[model samples]
Target chain A: MPKQMSRHSTVLKSPRRQAGKPRPHSGEPTHGPLTAEELQLAVRNHSMPLEALRKDTTPPGLHYVLTHFDIPFIDTDHWHLQIGGAVQRSLELSFRALLRAPSITIPVTLECAGNGRSLLRPRPLSQPWVLEAVGTAVWTGVPLAYLLTQAGVEDDAVEVLFSGVDTGVQGGVRQQFARSLPIEEALRPDVVLAYRMNGAELPPQHGYPLRLVVPGWYGMASVKWLSSIKVLTRPYDGFQQAVAYRYQEDADDAGTPVTWMKVRSLMVPPGVPDFFSRSRILPPGPVLLTGRAWSGQGAVQRVDVGIDGKWAPAHLEHPPAPFAWCAWSMPWVADPGEHEVSCRATDASGAVQPLEPVWNYQGMGNNVVQRIKVTVGQ
Target chain B: MPKQMSRHSTVLKSPRRQAGKPRPHSGEPTHGPLTAEELQLAVRNHSMPLEALRKDTTPPGLHYVLTHFDIPFIDTDHWHLQIGGAVQRSLELSFRALLRAPSITIPVTLECAGNGRSLLRPRPLSQPWVLEAVGTAVWTGVPLAYLLTQAGVEDDAVEVLFSGVDTGVQGGVRQQFARSLPIEEALRPDVVLAYRMNGAELPPQHGYPLRLVVPGWYGMASVKWLSSIKVLTRPYDGFQQAVAYRYQEDADDAGTPVTWMKVRSLMVPPGVPDFFSRSRILPPGPVLLTGRAWSGQGAVQRVDVGIDGKWAPAHLEHPPAPFAWCAWSMPWVADPGEHEVSCRATDASGAVQPLEPVWNYQGMGNNVVQRIKVTVGQ
Candidate 1:
């Protein structure tokens, strides 16, 4: 019999462990490293563990979890791309043709459409993403602008449409999902129709053959399993346009509709109330307080790190590459005491993270200040 | 040691026997049906088996193959959604709240970005799809527009963003994926942020808790594992925008650089040439000419079926559900001579399938008329 299989990487270790009693903080005047049980307890409660305290950047393996149905595999040899609509001529190309075009790679950040949903007062009806819905990638492919130019997009062209190859049956309903974009963004020089990620060909798990990579926008803009591109005079109201990426204003306990939300950011590490107690021991002195920052509008201009409500100058790492998270660090002089750490960021477009809480029905674009507590002791 | 597991369904029959070769026309033409040996050969070569002559709608199990990657599973309790960006407030929600929202259901078709790719000459680098990348389903979810209205979109808001909780590495690049829509489309009534597919909650294979159900477009925009949404003043310029979705003009080979492709449709099934030559004993009597039709623009207004290059009208199912392939059927009136059949479609937007070929870098937007053949008896 042909084999049936489930494939997951062997390199990574599962973070989930057997359940135990939740750890309660003891207000004792002592300094020592936390026990393994204490670390597991903290994580179970959605709090950062001690190892998470060691680095500002959350390791990819330990990042939060979010998944839908099973991942699908797509063969690339026979893949094709079709471009039609408000253009002088329509075209269809092969995967090899797409790769031969002028290639550009951009480092971009993709945040989940519902990041930080776990933090909501009344949990939303979705995966409980414990703040791990973000990542950086170098996408390489031909620019959409280059293609549209070749097609001779008409002056009246308004929107660009995108589609992918994945299919599934939800209940009994069959779906041919798709989304569209404005011609303006479709013609942007940096907008890429990527076939490669990092330095390698796209993995089947990702969109192989071709996928749309629109920077500075949510990941939805980057369609996977891409097949067709249509230039439209007006707009097409597909389910995604009319339904998916939206939010509600009123804090209705029932949940709001999906629409766009406000700009927001998150502190990478030293999570809110990071420290468990004054008795917890910390690493050696002169520690590096590193974290990640990003903005929906443009590049992050600056990030501020504060300890115990006092602002400290932060060492901002110019984005390692464009369209990526900006790494920032602060050198802290450790002393045995209770410490509350926080970070905030400002974007080049003059947008800054909010210090107070903001509420939306869908829990979108939430860039509230990130806070973590730490106890420095020998 | 951890026990190894297999995901194969016990309820289903063995796939091995199902994967067989099509039969050759012979005898009274109706007996044991196509042997297993013949069926396998037909599928491998992207050819139709003769057994298709007996039925109207393709059996569910025999549906064409198209996929982006492996199926994924995500823990629901820990999943959450985050919404923020260009709004009055940022919010975070858990999976629970999303399910509690007022939900609506609608039928839509979701096709792979690469359906009919095998029709492209000179082979592309991806899967060789034979026009089965599409499916229809009744999706239930809250209108994203409703959510956006609740978000109290700011005056400058131009684009709405969507993010997913799903994650994977492509070409060594780690990305947290998301997509977006224009404000106009975002407010459309037809769009839905779906959580339940058909009558039941979405299966894990199909975005479990929620996914964007953008009708009339392609599949990628319906980002699964939704986590966040954002509103922006200007359009996004992420890698997916500039490089992946775009296609090249006049480049037919797989090596060409193309960003986006044109809008096109194919006549699946009845009109597909060489419809089914794999069976040895073909079904006798009136042959049912049946197929599916769809377009990237909107609803398919009409589908025409042709036998032996002679045009004949086919009846399209009523209420032609949006984003879903419309099923059509017609009597073949089998004669004693060899005959060829074909089918074509026109969408509500006045876009019709082309008889001639169009060229593009990625070979997307095929929409060429599909042809099938049948040899009648002595």
Candidate 2:
């Protein structure tokens, strides 16, 4: 596990790091300590390996783990969920109490708002992500709607704010991790306070005691290690809610808040060389092309593959679970030559992956088309 | 169940009937009789209702069923798989033997190569199809690879042909429904001889005793009610193989043969009025849009949703099973007015759904983008 201290100072220093100069800390954090293994897995400058996308189902341990600061170590016994503010009744529930409440399981893909940030041209200097900050899992927990109903939300309540246990200074503000949603969205039945991931108790890095699983939204909305829920009469102005995570087109205007994930597709790079492997040349024959496509707002409507410039449809496989990624494959007759293969995804909402990513200050939602190169041999 | 007689002569007369004129039999078959129910379900001039695409998972019985002639009643007790030709030894495996063989389950989407035929302009006079002839299912049975290995294919074997018990006259040839694949494809692990669908024994209309399931190919490659497997030293020149199902640019020249599915998408129409329905007028707010997309040649790379001319990416849900269609959704803010919504699919192979279908003689593989109309109320 890695931990960070002097959270506020780090926040103030982020801008200096963003000035396109080499990181002052020389690729090492001055405040946080990371184990060799933890440092090895951190999202420094690399994307999730393209080959990982071919997995039929991502295992929990193997699932990609990403965070803004450092992994917080929380003691489960001391953890509690406090529901207060504009609600008719304020309630404090322990971990056991949450488990005793009515529960449901849903499969959802959680993607960091900056999953493809590194690909954006003139890249922003924040936490550099490159398409690996996403994973799908079956979350089991009590529906947040049930908890809200039990707390007796008042009509005056306009927004629901969730606060997590992780404390850090971000965007020059010292604060606990928090985000808010409109009251109507807070009550969606599919939104849950998950305590388990993929059938096991949630992992420590993922949020052991409890976390908010906001389906169809970017991972930012899913506040991990959740601690408190406040029914607010006014819009939430938490640091995470009103400042850092907001997507701005320019410095002078208030930009749209990053929410659901944009439509995107990534193809698993086929047959590349490894340390023990000697060749990248594929024997001439029918090649099975495969990958995963997803969107935050809806189900994947379709995905198209391109070889150089010629395009064709690929066979889409049924998703193993709802709200999970659909696996797809196509058989390509390998021509003996180098080929640039690409994949594009379209969501049911009619949104297609852009060939070039839309650049933004925060580098949120860079869902451009993905392409890879491969060679076929005689 | 529907049944038809005069299997052979009807096949011979098909070309004469296909010669650009109103069906000479006035929608009634000149050779065989059709039950009233079968005729009613038969596609006349419409595509599968766009509403059907909204289903998260198509129920087994509700899945679309299409056939060339009639549903052949198969008796499991008497059915057996005969494997011969270019093999060291011939093998006759009974239904029981097949059940006892090593088996695996796979989820796959099967689409008629002619699914969008009726949508093509100057519509070719043939088995009219407008996208309904496709469905996804969980197929369970013995791997075709195991059977191929058991028979011990000879060194010179080049092609593998599968024959179904569905005997009928098609394209002027009186024969059983048959298709062939290159030897490499026939040995792939994913190919199976399926006897179960969605966890139950195969339905009569969907090939009861056994069927061939070629995961990434068009439905035509999956011969229904499979009866025999023949390994050949050259390409099998069956009528269905050498003649029909071929794509032709002009009527005079020999056209390229059609294989695998093209990229395509269909939207489940949202909210329509009926006697029991209270209202189709959606309360003005964020509407969740959803649908499924697929391809035969490769995995769907992307799906784009368009409202009039405005397009945005929809969030895609994780696929529930392998080789099944991916469900996708998007949040749309409805404006009060009539709107035309459309979805286009792009496959991993770079094939995109055409705005207008490419007209062909046989109307094979018309993967035109689909559009629908909807109204939003204040």
Candidate 3:
């Protein structure tokens, strides 16, 4: 018997998940043609263009962006970040109050958990990103630890949840765009409540008024348009925390939650592109290749340029900040022929980007190396 | 015989076009599955979120964007807007010099020529927009007419061409992003050399340093990242002017050039949306239906809200500025059942959006009325 379904019961695809899949969607196929839902999501969200790798601090507008729901228009005069739930004394800080708090500005690189989803063989039918979903920005705000301590967090609290005004349904559950971090991790000095990006007030799309900037973790952990904080006594089972952004080998697997960004590198395509095919057409001469490299777990220690599968070390610049991406470059003399160029990065912790994509059901943490093809025209 | 193809000759999809289709792409299908190329373009170029209609002037970060190529990194110190060719006095104005010129700030609504392409049958194989590609921003800069007068246009000049630094190949032609306006239209008091949007310096994505704002014209005519201006004695036949942005009946037609935006109205989807299907769920009773309406041909004079295809005039606020979109709202008693709601706009020039989508080969100037479905759950 076919069961009647109300639209509300239909699972809304998260920014990282496909919609309308079968129940329990275990046999989620690895790859398929892009869907109408995916196209809808793609146009509403955008990523850094590869060419932006040339800049150190990405120009604010060129940074990758993925908003789970509509950007909320906050009236700064009335807006406040309320901290409650299992705290000794709840703290409500107005936008002006937040501005007066001790501020620290630092550069950070943020990459979406599904940065290379489209490159996965059985591509997870989500945003369909082909690399490019990464950017670095200088942020100014108060450290999360500074506020949590001032609010007097209760000892029993196991995690702290952040909630934003943006709301939508995903996985058949209507919910605010929210997430939680473990208490110990939430107290990290680097986690900030940012109000400024680059040198200006936060752009609304990047979460104006107040936003959480969780360094080292994938962008999902850096919640935007934040409105509240809840110190919880128990682990958070929110939709964002327990259901999406997980790496699963099969449908039924509970899946490990994704966190830190993996070591990765991308090159600015080194020639004039054939616009339609995105193939490079270069004149035979010495070509200087350039790119950016980063990782969440540790500093990027090395980058290697792959010319038609042959490896050569590239020069790496000092990282701008603790978690910011570093620029890298190499010189190659062009010959009259077609050639393939690839770049790979290794982090201080020694996690190197894989030569080929490592596929997963939800398509998270895909830090596969990037390769570009160019033809040297005489 | 099967014709051989070189990747170069392959037509790369333009922001408003499809690639690799049958040359003389005349029988371009009206409906088909979304392709990888279209999806790629969608993520790179974003549109306004319908909910943003609530704001009079779109927040800077939420404005719709369509870039045909990578954003150029301009060095303001060295960048200059050179007015040359048929001008009586070829003049070069540095960024600072342009800023020092007389200035004005006004709100202007800009809509993409292909705003509703995705809704067309045999959908145009381009950026598949669904009625969200429009935004209004307050632009501040020198009036373009002021600059032209300073350069002293030669009497023989027929068209004034503007070139941007961003370059890419389109229609198999590698060229900078360029477009031209008739000399008369170029002298309009409202046409401006905008350096600031909504207040601050233009964001890189919106065209930093300098951009052109042609009120009452489709977005393509308002060039960004301006590098130079060439006044031509002969009619301009650049690729952007001659090959793209045209209204055509079939593939082989050298259709009339597309200019003014057609009258259009878009409703904010009333009630909360079902995450997956985007259907609305509302409690039964009186609810406010709100949206924005505008036209490049003339001021939006009226907007009609349709409840189950029944029409009622909505109340419109005086427009924020001559060319900015006006907000409109209507009240409806949503009953407990499935219903379709739609809105249509009529411009002062007597142009009304058609109930049906007006199709075209290039998918330009599609001003179809927008419709949404909802279920009032009792």
Q: Which predicted model would earn the best TM-score?
A: 3
A269: Cα error in model 1, Å? 3.7
Per-candidate clashes, comma-separated: 223, 72, 7
Q: Considering only chain B, what TM-score does candidate 1 achieve?
A: 0.73
Lowest summed lDDT over 10 consecutive residues: which window, candidate 2 chain A? A1-10
Ranking by TM-score: 3, 2, 1
Per residue, candidate 1 scores C-alpha lDDT tens digits across B147-210 of 7777778899998888776443221223455567777767778788888765656654466677
For model 3, the DockQ equals 0.37
Instruction: For candidate 1, write residues A68-108 as lDDT tens digits.
Output: 22223456677679899999989898887887889887876
Alpha-carbon error at A214 in model 3, in Å? 0.7
Worst 10 residues of 2 chain B by lDDT: B1-10
Question: Model 2's DockQ?
Answer: 0.01
Per residue, candidate 2 scores C-alpha lDDT tens digits across B1-378 of: 001111111112222223442211112222222222222223211123334465554444335555554346677788888999999889999999899999999888777777766455555545545556677788999999898998999999999999988664443345677889889889989899999987878865567789998876778888888889999999997777766666654343345556666777777655442111111334466777778987655567778899887887766665555457787776778888878778887766666778876766667777777776566766
lDDT scores for all predictions? 0.53, 0.66, 0.80
The runs of at least 3 residues in candidate 2 whose Cα sits more than 4 Å from the true structure, single-residue gaps closed, are: A1-48, A274-281, A320-322, B1-378
Can you write out model 2's per-residue Cα lDDT over A203-283, one digit (the tens) per residue?
A: 655776798988877788888888899999999966677556656554433555677777777776565421111113455
How much lDDT does candidate 3 score? 0.80
Give the worst 10-residue stretch by lDDT in candidate 1 chain A.
Answer: A1-10
